[model samples]
Target: MSVIGVVASATGGVEQLREGLVRPLLDREHQVAITVTPTAAAWIAPAERWELERITGLPVRSQPRRPGEARPHPPIDLFVAAPASANTVAKLALGIGDNQALSVLSEGLGSTPMVVFPKVNAAHARHPAWAGHLDTLREAGVVLVEWELLEPRTEAKRELPWDRVLAAVDGLADQFFQGRLRDRGAGVADGGDG
Candidate 1:
């Protein structure tokens, strides 16, 4: 099973993260670890955080570990940033690791498979740098869930397009494992005994 590291930022639909992303991932038998932006940590209730911990069986991190502290979550095979705010996307594109969430995403940029769903609005997209930020991430091989796929936000709450995000994750993880398996097979074919 792949270890999926979910990073949530302070966005409108972040409250639904457990239901929309985490729980479904667990149901699919993937181990899940969560890290939230500082603002997001505050946005989620303490009781909710406890529930997340109980279900995932891992601590939900929002802050960096101290000098001697061992890492809390296991090494991640894939990363998902669902409900990623515009600010988070900008920081990630600029390689800014101001907080734990951004730090993880920043480090995983090109090496680890990542799927980011930027929960943004029209105004945010109109920003001149927005296109450039997306280009940078795409160049790094990050699978971006297009904004058009998300339902338009209204006075009444709307759910984020978690299905699309998860689909991207599933596809990327499959490709990653297949590539690894192919490499191993190639090694064996070349008479490298393991």
Candidate 2:
């Protein structure tokens, strides 16, 4: 199974993450590790941290990993930030790793396929700085997972669909598998399990 590192930020749509994103990954037999921003953790009513841990079977990280720690962050084939707030997105664009979620994103910037499902409100999205941040991420090879940025509160939050993200990851996983198979084939053909 492919492993996906999911970063959930503090946003209005954050509460829907488990059902919208994590459950689909589980159904697809993909392993998921979630890192919730400290602000998001607090925003979640009744605190779904324990529930998420149970569902994912991995500790839900909410703090940055200490340097030289014996244990390290779980390895993953892909990275995603869902319900990413304007603040989180901006920090990531600026390469700020001050928080756990952003730190993971910073590490995955180039090596891993990264997608961010932003949930910016009209007011925030219209800010002049928002465009610069997005541009920075684009230059860094990060894909901004987007849905219709319509008027907010008029309807349910229309962030990038979780299914869309899953489909994208599936394609990435296929590429990864094919690459590995090619490497293995090359080794075997060389008269060694290289």
Best by TM-score: 1
lDDT of each: 0.93, 0.81
TM-score of each predicted structure versus truth: 0.94, 0.86
RMSD of each: 1.9, 2.4
lDDT of 1 by residue, 54-102 (tens): 9999999999999999999999999999889999999999999999999
Tell me, by lDDT, which candidate is best.
1
Model 2: per-residue lDDT, tens digit, 21-122? 988888889889998899987887655777888899888888866788754446878887887888899999888988889888998897787878788767
lDDT of 1 at 98: 100
Model 2, CA-based lDDT: 0.81
Error of 2 at 107 (Å): 0.9
